[model samples]
Target: MEVETNNNNSYLSVVRRSSRRTSFPTLQGLYVSLFEGEITSDGLDLSISNKNTGKEFNPKLLKITFFLSIFISTVLCLDHGFVSCNLEYIEKSFGVGYAQSSFIGSMVYMGFLIGCLLTGLFLPVLKSKVLLIGSLIFVVFSGIYSSKSLTLTEIYASRFFSGFFQAFSIVYLPLWVEKFSPQSSTTTWLAYQQLFSMVGVFFGYLLGGILTCFTAEDINIYYMSSSEKLSSLFISWRGPFIIQSALIIPIILILIFIPGEILDVGDQEQLSEIEYSKTTGLLVSGVDLRRSTNNNLLPDENNLNKRNSKLRRSSVLLIPSQSNNPNSSKSLEIREICSNPIFMFSTFAVCGVYCFTTCTLFWLNQYFVEVIKVDRITSVFSVACIYLSGPTLGVYIGGITGDLINDYHPNGFGFILTLCTIFSFIGFITSMVVAQTHPYISFFWGMIIILFFLTSTLPMSLIVIMKSVSSKTRQLASAIAQFSFNFVGFLLSPVIIGIIMDIIEYFPFGALKRRYNPIEVGIKIMLYISLPTFFFYSLATLCSYFNCLISPKITQKKIIIANQIDIPKQLFIK
Candidate 1:
């Protein structure tokens, strides 16, 4: 069971662990073993080698497997986009009004919020892979059950469970990808994770659009009751669940055969050095005291008392390791991050940005169909195209540009993000102004270009927050930051937008209804008024981020110096 590494070279040597272990451990056995008290306090150790190799999987296989897993798991991400695109059809099929149908969206978000909290609780104990696999199973079951739903209550329950389970995939997939990826390529891999999730969203839009074409045209189902719609064979509202299930099953099968982690043989020297330092007690993980003996810092090694006390104070922070009482240290770190103004401003900025994105995702299709007077097919295609082309491209552009700027100026990333948000704010206003007269043009200008600008702020703000915190707290900080944004964006935006739309549409005004249809007027007014609030709020948050960056008390000089002094890569999070 001993792991072997060559002293002469950096490569890890293979040690065949077994011959009868023909396949990787089953998900059930993995969880059962942990539940029976085999768990490690340091956290889940899923790096157990592929059953056959004893060494890490081939690099190419590892990359393929990781990307494929992300793609498959994100099939659950299709829920919102699919629902948004087909909301009208679903409402009609269920014989529900706008206010009543909003509950379905609310249920999904509620489940998602609850799921995230529960997943976060178990994240440090269970293998993320097991949570991911278990969540996918429940998601598939929910999707199938949803497809066969007979009543509004049944569909709500199905959607809630689906959202609940999908939360595991959402919160864990990025962390899992980061764990397996090499340090150098971590950002790129995370970016791809975001990209693939958007790709899933596009598929959701496309799926709903395509299936909606199969609606039985002979019968006017819009006027029919819920029971009448249910009797029909071609109810398009159920199609997304069935199609998503078909797409996800094969991916889950493939992932079970793939290994859980990729061993980074390149970090062998660093790993050995840390182990040696731990035993000698001369160096902490982030401190460079181990190198002091080789350099002029400790010239008189025999007379250890001659060593400078100031040097020790400057180099090491002496924090408790995870093997010790992790709870105390984690609590302390959480308090530290939460109290820091930089973390707060940047987190809120990201939250606002995400809330804006979610609003568009849930309402843009309805806006186009109802207010802009666009055809259903064109509206769906336009929304899909915007997602397909906007957010991913925006993230790449922002990430690369922000990296270059941060290299030259410590706060340059925030500066640039602020400017982008201002531009996005302007774009949002202009789009709403022009949407009525030039609807198609607004789709291109408002949805695509504005998103391109606004979405870039996401990665920029994330990097700022990541850099602001200490390395020991990076993982927790990142989790908490994401949870904050998702809570506002996913759990709140849609229902609020729907409520506003209903309030405007259903207001008592006999004269106004006679002059212009109340429903159309309400939707048009809601489209014009409701969506801009998030973008404007996001702009305000970015301003706060910029202010925090330039404040007198805030400084990154020490962190930058640490980076410049060749601190090991393990001490930094991108």
Candidate 2:
């Protein structure tokens, strides 16, 4: 049996190398390889297996879960995009100015911050599925409430709760991907998750744009009060929320009916030693294949000495080893995560990226309508196209690139991040500086370029942060990341931009204020203020790369732990 196992191992290694070459270069092949996890295009072995049982689990369950995850992400993101694009309508409906209307956006993040706090508190006590179900229920209710909201206060409350519940999906969905996805493909899967999120945003903008086109130019011009606004025959701004509520109902049903035993992200120990099996292709259940490697167990004295030397060098480069015990106190886990330099830097990088995105998406529609002199439909649709062509597609590209680079050399992922951030910074500055004098079409294309680089950093940043922590701390880590990114991006960016605009509008320029359009000048200045964030993003990724130099072991262990694989004692070199 031992001899046969060794032979199978050698055969698998040879297949892995050859499979890369034989793999079809088409997008269809990649898609089939990702979800179906089968031998694709004659050579790529994408199927997952069980090392102990020497069998593959049915792909049906995985397919359902994967698509379902994507569905939930996409649907939730629609609400965000809808609200963002419809901010002008919302402002008129509520009879509020830019500063007040900005709350509609910031309030969601406030709710998100609170949700993250509660999720961190309850995560250990409840199953993730239970939390997810509870969150979805609230999300549905919030959507319904948002559509029916008559008062500015009601809109604020609804959006806040909507944002609050969304935190659960944001934090746990990626964890679900981590649980069921193949280790080798986790980055790609996450990128897909983000890609769909951007897609949902685009569609949300599309929905809002389509609805806005039908709205009367003076739809809410005569309505002064909340009751009067609600009394109108049809309120276009509320359409997306109503539609979102209806869509969520069926999703809730699907989630409820899906077997908990299959979908639940429970304790990792309850799972078998899961890892990427060379023979099985991508994912394998119920086995530790750490010792399957030739480098770990060579009997020859020369090979043994060489392996030991490698281990010694690796040990020096690793930081203080993380506590693997899952039962460790939440406070301790939080402290460790907060103190980790890599996690902190990655969070900063994500913060900068998300902040830029939030500001652009939430405010650009209004900026286009009021400043660029474009009609409402054009502004909304143009923003939609930017989202679709830029971040939506960029995230997918980043994920694929990151995984391929990591496969080539682990250090390569860091370089990818650094280069992406630099491009983003340059693109942002060029776009904002040039938009003043360029044609709107030119400005639109510039935005697409800027967002492409800006959002491509997300998947890579997420990968870095996830790799920086232990399995026991991942949920908490995700919660912190959720809180951090949204707080900076969603909660602060809009409000800051809004406040700055108000300040500029009200500033005692006397005669000069009439000469310049305050809205135009304010937007330009606000965007420039935000430009430094991209520079910081570049700085953080650079710092993360240097941090990785002394901690490559942590990277390897975390990747294994991410797949729910327990390291065997024998696999460790003495």
Task: Name the candidate that leads on lDDT.
Answer: 2
lDDT of each: 0.55, 0.63
Per-residue alpha-carbon lDDT of candidate 1 for residues 441-526, written as tens digits (9 for 90 to 100): 74556567656766766655655565555433555565677667667766665666666556655568743435554334443443
Q: Model 2, range 439-478, lDDT digits (tens) per residue?
A: 7877788778777877777787777677556554676788
Give, for candidate 2, the lowest lDDT window spanning 10 residues.
25-34
RMSD of each: 12.3, 9.6
The superposed Cα distance between candidate 1 and the true structure at residue 491, in angstroms, equals 2.4
Query: What TM-score would candidate 1 get against the native?
Result: 0.69
How much lDDT does candidate 1 score?
0.55
Q: Which residue runs of candidate 1 sit more than 4 Å off their true CA positions?
A: 1-57, 216-235, 263-330, 402-439, 509-574
What TM-score, over all chains together, does every model reach?
0.69, 0.76
Instruction: Estimate candidate 2's RMSD in Å.
Output: 9.6
Maximum-TM-score candidate: 2
